[model samples]
Structure formats: C-alpha cells, structure tokens
Target: MSRTGIATGPNALRGIVMMCLGMACLAINDAFAKYLTDVYSPVQILFLRNLIALPFAVIIAVRLGGWDAMRTRRPGLHLLRGTLWLAAATLFFTGLRYLGLAEATVLIFAAPVIITGISALFLGETVGWRRWSAVLVGLVGVIVVVRPGGDAFQAASLFPLATAFLYAILMISSRWVPAEESLWTTMVFQVLAAGALAGLASLWFWTPVALSDLWLFIGIALAGTLGMTLITEAFRFSEAAVVAPFDYTALIWATLLGYLIWNETPDAMTWLGAAIIIGSGIFIILREARPG
Candidate 1:
C-alpha cells in the first residue's frame, strides 16, 4: 500500500482488489494470533512479530526508493504513531483473548466515525449536515452493537472501543505527515520502535516458544507488511469515505475463519449487531459520496 500519491492507471482498480486481499490476510493474521495466544504469551508474540517484521518494512521502504526517500520532516509524528499503534495492537489482542474476533473488529471500525469528529473540531475540516447526521447514526449503530450496561453486553468488548481512539488518532496524524516520507520509513520506525518496547516488556515474563512458532512468526511478518501496504494503497487510490465501508469484508473473513479454525460461531445477537453496524456504515459512506 504505497502512499506515494493518488494512484492512477489500471493499477488503481487493482488497488481495490489488493485491498480486499489485504483484509483477508489480516483476518488470517488475527486468527493466527488468537491461536498462538492459547500456547504463548501475548507479549512474546508482539515482541517477535515486530522483530521479524522490521527488516521486511525496511526492505520494502528501500525497494520503494532509497533510504533518502524515506526522510521525513517529522520523525516525532512517526514515533508517536508507532507508540500508539503498539498500544492499539496490545489492547486489541488482549481484547481478542476474551472477545470474538469479529466483534472486536466491528468495534474498531468505530474509528472512522471518531475521525469524522476529530477532523471537524481539530483539523477544521468542514462537515456538512449529511456527514454530521451520518456520524450520529453511526454512533447509534455502535450503541446497538455494544448495548453497554446491559447483561447482554460483553465487558471485554469495551477494550477495542477504548483502543480505537488511539488508532484513530494515529491515522489522523498520518494524514498530516510529510508526504515525502516513504511508507517504508514509517513502517520501519513502527516495527523497530514497538518491537524494542515490547521486547523490554516481555523480559519480565518471556516464555520460550517452539520452533514451529518461530515459523509462524515469519509468516506473521510477511503477512503484516503485505497487508499494511495493500491497505495503504487502497486508501491512496480510493476515497476514504468510499473505501472505508468495504472494511466490512474483514468481518466476513473473520467470522468464517473463527467458525472453521476456532469453532467459535457468532451467536444470533452478534450477527444482528454486526449487520446493523455494517449496513449503517455503508449507508453513511454512500451518503457522503453523493454529489452535493
């Protein structure tokens, strides 16, 4: 997902397909993460994943262009993004330990709606009445999904919702980041910074992983780089308002993977809530895309 510029040519359409593929890969990654957690510490998993992924991120950046192209005016912003992303990953993974993958993911999607408000108040981006209404409606849909304070609510479900604001803030900063900064540089910084921190944290309770788990780490690295690139390209070529709704693709993939791999079937209430959230999200995107 090269964020060089708004992609053009036949490749633009291809980006959309790649984006979907990326979502599928991400679903696979999450499934694998959940499986590994059963046998390994989540901190161990996070540390190794970043260490394995750092080289790939650097290589991708170099392949995209030289190290010189990776230069950024705001290393601070990238550092901040890396730190928050670590928190987001750790929190979401912890939530996954207790919540269904699809459910946690749906909650994270709340970031888009959060971004809308952030853009309006902080970035001074104009919000038309339609988008404002969409934001409100999107919140209603999230409420339908979470149903907080009720016995039906899953307490662990709130973790992703809490972490999502961090993810949203990271993404918002990414938008303002210097365009010249190679995606690879940003990615490299992310992996290295987070890996180092997680490694330090894991020192208190490091568990030895089996050889086969090391192989899984390799796969995690590659899948993460590819998924991140594809998703970045997706946003570059397509409007965020248009492309965001397609994120529901992850839920379908997650649900299928969860059922087959983990034997965890989402209940009827889960399905209904997901449908409301996804359907309303797509509707919001469509309304925003309409020509005014």
Candidate 2:
C-alpha cells in the first residue's frame, strides 16, 4: 500500500499503540545518550548515532523499494528537514547532560502545542479557540517546568525547549512532503544528512571512544533508528494529532529509567508542571479529533 494509504480501518488504534512503543524506544535511547554524554561531546554522539543508524535505514529503504525508492524531487526540503533534525537532536542531547531525564522529556512534550500553532500559522490549518487556548495553557506548563530565574532553573533547560520548537518545525515540514515518497526514503535522508552535518562538526570535539563503549554507540544507533521508524510508521497509519498525544508516554518511561539507572528524581514542581503540560496536550488532541 502507498504510505498515505496505510491509514485505514483499525490503523488508528494500531498507530496509537505503535506510537507508545516508539516512545519507549526513544526514551531508552535518550537515557543511553545521556549516559554517554559523560564521556563524549554532543556532536560526537550525534555523528556516531547517525552513522551507525544509516545502514539500517538504507536496508529498510531498499526493502520498501530498490534504490529508486529513495529518489525525491524535493531535495531542498529534505535537506532542511534533516538540518532541523540535527539541531533538535544536538540540543536535546546537550540538555540531557544537565537536566534530569524526566524534566527534559516533559519539556519536549510541549512540541505538540507548538506543532498545533505552527500548523495553524504555516500550514494554514484551521484551529479553533479551544485548541488555541490549550496551546496557551501548554506554554504555561512549560514555564512552570522551567521556572525561569528560580533555583530549579538551569540555562541548559532552554535547550529542550528550543529543540521542541525546531522539532515542531520539522513535523510541520513533514506534512508538506509528498505522500508518495517512501517512508524509508525520508528516514534514510534524515540519517544520512544529519550524519554528514554532524561528521563535519565532530572534527573539533572528537573524543576517542574506548573499545568497551562501542556497544553503547551500537545501542544508540539501533534504538534511534528503530524508534524513529516506528514513529514514522505510526504517523503513516494515523492522523498526526491522533498519534501525537501518545508521545507524552515518553515521560513515564524516562522517569522510570532515570530513577533506576541514574537515581535521578523529579521534584514536586516538575511533576506538577508535567501534569499540566500533559493535560493541556490531551485537551488539544481531543479538540482536534472532534469534527469541525
């Protein structure tokens, strides 16, 4: 079936479930990246992650169709999307070095709200007052979590917020991509383009990896590639708004992983802010799901 044609009966439910699974993989990947940040720079981590993931992506692309499946008329758009992906990953990984996993996860959840706004402004989609209000409330949740000028705040906290904005842009841009393009093609471009860009940047900050750490780099590649492929498939089988809210599930995974692996815990304020953000995001999803 064509990529866009995958959205059919029962696919919406499947999409939601797949999105949750994808988020779990992503949360685990983030934890691994955070752990590696202790010894490697963000660029180095990004370069390795993308470089390792590229082969798997290429395999998937070929399975979907031969090399011709990866062809695209809109190279510039793919390049732009790839650049945004690189920026988002770099910022989020860098922020993870300082912020607790759960905190960073919650902040990134704000992307749905930003995506809603961007869809309205740039995609020219009609957004009702209710969803707009939800967007505003979601921003409040972000502010609560950041707690700017307060002791809980770190300048690094802004990195995830910026990442969320860039990710929102990437998601919006994806909607513009021709549906006929194979999902594997898009995925391949994302890894290849980001890998090339990060490879150039890693030259200055490169750090030698111990033989023992090779497994971590491999894990990063597998988790990231698999996670993103599942999420992309979820979007293929469901509406973006329908699949998006499930992304908030990442916070739950991140919280558990953070505590077990790093002994990190989110304070009461962070929990409260997360609840607010999640609530607002759910409201937006519900509003969008309704008939106009």
lDDT tens per residue, model 1, 1-292: 3343323456556666777888988887787777777776667788888888887777777776687745677867767887888888888888889887887887877777787778898999888887787778767767877888878798888788878788889878888777777666677777777888789888986888898788887777677778887787787677665456667799888888888876877777677766766765676666655555
Estimate the lDDT of model 2.
Answer: 0.89
**TM-score of every candidate relative to the true structure:** 0.88, 0.91
Model 2: number of backbone collisions: 0
Per-residue lDDT of model 2, residues 1-292, tens digit only: 2343334458888999899999999998999999999999988999999989998999887886688767987788888898999999999999999999999999998988999998898778998898899899999999999999898788999999999999989977887788888777788888888899999999999999999999999998998888887898898788877787788899999999999999999999899899989999888876776654
Error of 1 at 137 (Å): 1.8
Clashing pairs in 2: none
Deviation in Å, model 2, residue 155 alpha carbon? 1.4
Best by TM-score: 2
Off by over 4 Å in 2: 1-13, 121-124, 237-242
